[model samples]
Target chain A: MELFTPELGLVFWMFVTFALLFLILAKFAWPVIIKMLEERADMIDKGVVYAQNAKEQLDNAKSEAASYIAEARKQQAEILREADKMKTQIIEEAKAAATVEAKKVMDAANLAIEQARKASEKQLRQEVSAFALGIAEKVVRENLASESAQTKLVDKLLNEVENKN
Target chain B: MALAALLLAMPAQAAVTEGEGEDFNPKEIIFHHLGDAYGWEVPFSHSQRIPLPVIVRDCQGSWHIFSSNRLNDGASYDGFYIAHGGEYSGKVVGEQDGVQYRPLDLSITKDVAALWIAALVVLLIGFSVTRWYKKHNMKAPRRWTASFEFLVEFMYMSVIRPTLGSKAKTYAPYLLTAFFFIFVMNLLGLVVIFPGGANLTGNVAVTLVLALCTFFITNLRGNKHYWKEIFWPDVPVWLKCPLPIMQAIEVFGVFTKPAALCVRLFANMMGGHMIVIVLTLLIFIFAKFGPAVTGGITVFSVLFSLFMLLLDTLVSFIQAFVFTMLSTLFISMAVCDPHEGHDEAEA
Candidate 1:
């Protein structure tokens, strides 16, 4: 019972002692300790914020890089397609040129063949006429055994030709 | 001759039971340990003790300062003595002509001596930490200073900053000091050895002073808006009209908050010490049965007391934290912007 009761002396001593303690510690101890602590806490907070910002920036860069890669791949495929189309067009143009050249060469060769046939035909006719004349003259010379018989034949052919005229 | 004199003195100073209690009163044992005394009896020894100084201003208006050993067993030294386990168990009273008046006993009793030791230790720690900061400026602390920094930082971040908000930076030093002081005292109380077992925090007067400090700071720094919120709260108009009951409760809360802080710390610490003493005393209480019974009881007593002491160790930290945390909370509430709470509620 007495233990629970508050005594004046103890209370006074406690008040004086605690008041002095609080003041001493607050003055001497706390300033340095608390300042250091606050500085450290602020540093930690700044560190976390910086880390988060860096992470976000990295993520953004990675996404942007992915999009860039995709765009480059698309452009590469388009260029390859254009080159393929141009290659096929060049092949078609070469084929058309080769056909026109072949046609001109065939026509020139046909004209040359026709002129040679005509010349041959003229020479054949003249040769045939000359042969006929030579044969007839021999025949006249031999059969008539005289010029009169050949002349009679010639005169008869000339009279017939003059009546027809 | 000295040796013979010491041997004689040893027998004379052997453990003397102060109270007239039969059957090994465990209650008396607890009271004896928990109460402030003029002497500190060394545990586990019979004849060794330290006699504290006794300072008393008696009815004669003159001061008598002497060794408290003169008042052994309620014996008077210059008409002053300490009564043990009575209506006036923990006081110094003077009897002159059958008139008893309480003396102003501002003496270095057991608890006072312990308080000085605790104060010295706190000062030493404070000085060393200050020196560390001085020696190593802007660099990270090392070793024990690092641990101390961690503790202070924890209090700053967890308790002070969150509660006090902007004012936290200003009040952090005082709050940290209060926290460390209580923490050291509680831990010191847990040590049962000669040098460390001083129940400084368990004393009501010490807790009261700490609470008083908090109370004063909170009330003194409180703004008009705080008082307005307490007196005329942002409640329904009818609520205010009803006998101002809400307002009265707020006023009561102001005082009770600090009172609760003091009582809570004192009771918890005192209770822990009592439980430890009582548990150990149970063995002696059962000793008359038989040697075998006494041996069994002693074993259980020692084990249970050990467990209690461990629990007390944990309680010491928890109570200290609780006390400091509550103090921080109360002060922050008093000083924080009242509109912030209202806005939060509205949102």
Candidate 2:
């Protein structure tokens, strides 16, 4: 019977003690602890989101850099090919100009040589005609010294002229 | 050492029985240990008790305060005495009109002192955890604070949060306090020394107050749908119209929930303490058969007591958890949305 009994003093003290504990805890302790826990959870969640965003941005930057490098390489190859083509065309043009200049110089030399040969041939003909005339005159003079020879020569000339007519 | 101890205890038992010419009575011995007293008893000595304050009111409504030792050995002080065997046995009684009557005993008994100690322990834990959170500002806890935080978080997240959902925060303070309060008392009751041996949770008055708190919180917070389900449940019209059977059962169930909560905790803790005391008493009961019987039974009794104490330690934790979990469920039942229940019922 005593075991089952609920004494008045015990009940009063229990209520007083338990109520005091509850009021103090609820007002001060629980709020702070639970708030800090929530704040920490929120902070961790934000940190994870921020990390994911940073990773995505890094990936984007990496791909963009790779594309830029590829574009620059392509441009470099195009420039190199254009320069090679220009070098070959310039060489061919220079060779053609050199050949034309050499041909022009050879033509001028041939014309000059022909003119020089013609002039020399004309001078030699003139000298040969003059010499032959002078030799004939000397022979005529020597033959006239002998009177009889002169007369005979004149008659032979006249006879030849008549025969010709 | 145990045989020597038992042999030494034989003289004390002989001395007690010699005065009364009676054999050892285990019932009175167990009850004395299990029940509350105005003074704390020293181990191995019944006469030497640590005096505590005794505040009592006479039948004429006059309050008096004095040390409990003044009333030792059937002594009386200022018309007040501790009744030996009567309707008010073990209580401060006063004579009125040739009739025995109990006073308004607001004295701090052994159990009340232990209750205050348990409350102080809970407050210490609460403040320590609070201090850590305040200083660190969301940083992790360590050592005792860490273990305490783990218990709180586990209870909140697993039991309270799941059942109460959004309303968990509203009721968390009371629920968490109850959990720690009961758990601390249960653990304190397991110790056999100063500030530990009082059976606070096993006391019916203490459990009644705790259960009443749960009962009031549940019923006070009950939604409109809850009352409707209780009074006019979605049952056959015949049950409500003719018999009112379901309504009666629902109303009965509302009171039974808290009642069961009170009795369950009280009975478990009380039974555990009783069993330990009973086992220890076995040694004295077997002492008459000779030294061999007494020594053998002492070993058996001591071993069994140790085992039971270990078992009670686990039961302390489990009972606290069970009480808290059941309270959370009951509160959730009252506060939950009607639609969720309707869906479940249909499924």
Candidate 3:
């Protein structure tokens, strides 16, 4: 078909028309359009970067705060442990002091008891001798009237006294 | 007589398309529709039509300009008649001293007028957009500016960004312009009502010129790596041998790529026009049987033609998009760095 045929004049005109169209668009239209695109992309990218930086800073602050709390908790535990140890030492020292005081009181009481027991024994010997002497005097006065009884008793007593000396 | 009634009824700008008898010549009607015309045919008005201005240069290099009605109204003025048959059939021919010489018929034919109309409209739109950008450069765009900006952004991403990548910024001006130009031309072709329905892209001359531009840009800017890849592909030694068949095919591919791009657009667009014409012509074909048949088929014909028109509009936009995408793809392939090509192979 002649429909597929080419015409030179029309071809030439088409070239001229198209070239003019292209030139005008390229010069007037494209730069502004492209710049707008570039600027918008840059804006989006900067926003993302800013968001990421903020998130990172927030994360850092959170971690630091957690570590601070952890340190505070550890200090609290150490203080409690120290208090517990001090309470045990104080209890043990108090126990030792009470034991010493009790032993001193017991020793003092025992010495006093020993002193009383010696004194009592001495009094008991004195009383027993006195009673024996009284009885002997009474017997001597009443029975000396019988001469054989007094002489035999006096000789045995004198022999016993000489052996004791 | 049936063909005359049918022709008068059809709302086409084709000047002369009638044939003899029931064997109606659809070719004459179709070609008349496709070809340049002297005057636009107004339906049901045999003596009345919209006349185009005829401009022609004589053998003496003198120019004659007049209304096309003079040539069509059963008359020839100053020895020049719009030829009705043969290769120069719708063009003006001058009978200079007994020799029928075809002068330089440089009239603003139907498609040429359409092209002018398209160019002016595009320029007006572009100027308005530029103004809008100047005033509201900082704020978000509204109305047509928003849609236009969106289109620009889409081309930038889909065609420019993927193909050119980093160098997209550099070639954005040309790529964006080419996209809009083709899109507008195709869009105008779909408007059957008013002054917009002329097949500019269907003309081989126009598509050839467009393809030539792509060819020039692709090759002129084509790097050494591109040419090298064409000549020496990464094939086995045995494959590279055997009369350099692969290399020859690679080189041939470069030329055919643009040819294919232009032809595909032209054929798709022209095919739509043909189908619409044939569908409408069927009613007249059925008229030969009886008035009953003609009346019955007219309703169906009108409905199918309406459907075709809607589909044609969609095709127009799609064709424009395809042409722009392929042209950008070719340019990208030509100017891409060797490493980019390597990356493609790896991918």
Candidate 4:
């Protein structure tokens, strides 16, 4: 008994209003709305994908930069090593040249000292021979002054000369 | 004015004096009336009386027989005390242990309180859902918004899209709105959290209105093809002879579809409520005379009631789906061009 009571007027109006509203919505509103929603979703998805790719690219670039920096450091160390080697070679060559020059100078001074000592020794030998000859001459003159001794001395001298001959 | 004067003069003569014997408590009588008439008492003991034929009011100030014992737990008061039948008139019994109370006068019991409670629940649910929507941004649709979107998608894909085809997107808003509205309303009927104890979906008027809306939309949007199929048929000469009769019947069929929608929703919701009420009443019927019977019946009632409640929850969703599906089917049929040779060739 409680189930079927009718509110006739309300039922009529509800039908009318809903019919009008649905018409307007179906014709004008729904298509634009759904399209907009789908577009928005697609845009967001694209943006996210782009951001991810950019981040990956950024990471790659950072790694490449780090490698370049490392390579530069290595090249700098090689150049410094080469410079040190060149400096040491130049110093060694100069020292060798100075050593040769010093040896040449020492050889020349030794040659000059040898020549002077040879000349001095020759002159001293000649002077000593002359002094010996003079002393012998004086001794012979004193002996000849004794008379009988003179004749003997003369005969001895003759004998000595003959022996010498 | 006449009625009021009559009421006052008649009641003045019947006033009772002190020491004229123990007067019945009018408040107890009123409470008893509410409990007995519609089972509005609090259900404590299983042996308590089960109220039958509960009555309730709606937001429109209309009275209706909401459910039989089969659909609702007879109204319980203060969480106990199944109301027993009574009608008594007496003076105020004064305060008893600091609790002030009034006696009751003889009157027929009504269930306006129960009806009010049901309305309040409907209002609360509406408020809560609206508040939830307003508090959160739906542009990006997070959490609950996403959940609602999925639900809307499911309904569109499974129901409207298949039926309406090219026009499905255009019909999605109406279909989705109707689905949610009916779903929420049906769910409200199953939960009893209001002051009095009411079931809004049990009311026939609401179902009728919803059905009427579907009816108008279906007919208003009908194209030439729909009318042609109903009013004329392509058949052999012999069949064509009786075409007029068929056309007349087909015209009636148009109205019947929406009528069926109304009845289907109303009946299912009302039927589910009745079953739950009856299961609850079983406890009182079995336990009225003894504690042992009462204890056993109480357990049985609780289990059975829970089962029915679960079924009602499922039915609420199903009814909403069925209504939307049928409406979509009707609209699609109306808008489709049956005379198109392409469809005929394909078939």
For each candidate, give its TM-score against the true structure: 0.73, 0.81, 0.71, 0.49
* Candidate 1: residue B34 Cα off by (Å): 1.1
* Candidate number of the best TM-score: 2
Clashing pairs in 2: none
Error of 3 at A75 (Å): 14
| Residue B90 lDDT (model 3) | 67
lDDT (tens digit, per residue) of candidate 1 on A1-165: 655566677788777777788788877777767777667668989999999999999999999999999999999999999999999999998888888888788878888888888889889989988998999888866888978887898899999999999
lDDT (tens digit, per residue) of candidate 3 on B167-228:
77777777677667777877776665336557778878788888888888899999887888
Which regions of candidate 2 deviate over 4 angstroms?
A: A70-165, B1-22, B43-45, B287-304, B340-347
How good is the docking of model 4, as DockQ?
A: 0.09
Model 2, B204-301: lDDT tens per residue?
Answer: 99999999999999899999888998999999899998889999999999999999999999999999988877777777777678999988987897
lDDT of 1: 0.76
lDDT of 2 at B289: 87
**Superior candidate under lDDT, 1 versus 4:** 1
TM-score (chain A only) for the predictions, listed in order = 0.63, 0.67, 0.57, 0.62
TM-score for chain B in model 2: 0.91
Better of 2 and 4 by lDDT: 2
Candidate 2 docks with a DockQ of 0.53
Fnat of candidate 4: 0.22
Provide the overall lDDT of each model, using Cα atoms, as 2-decimal numbers: 0.76, 0.85, 0.76, 0.56
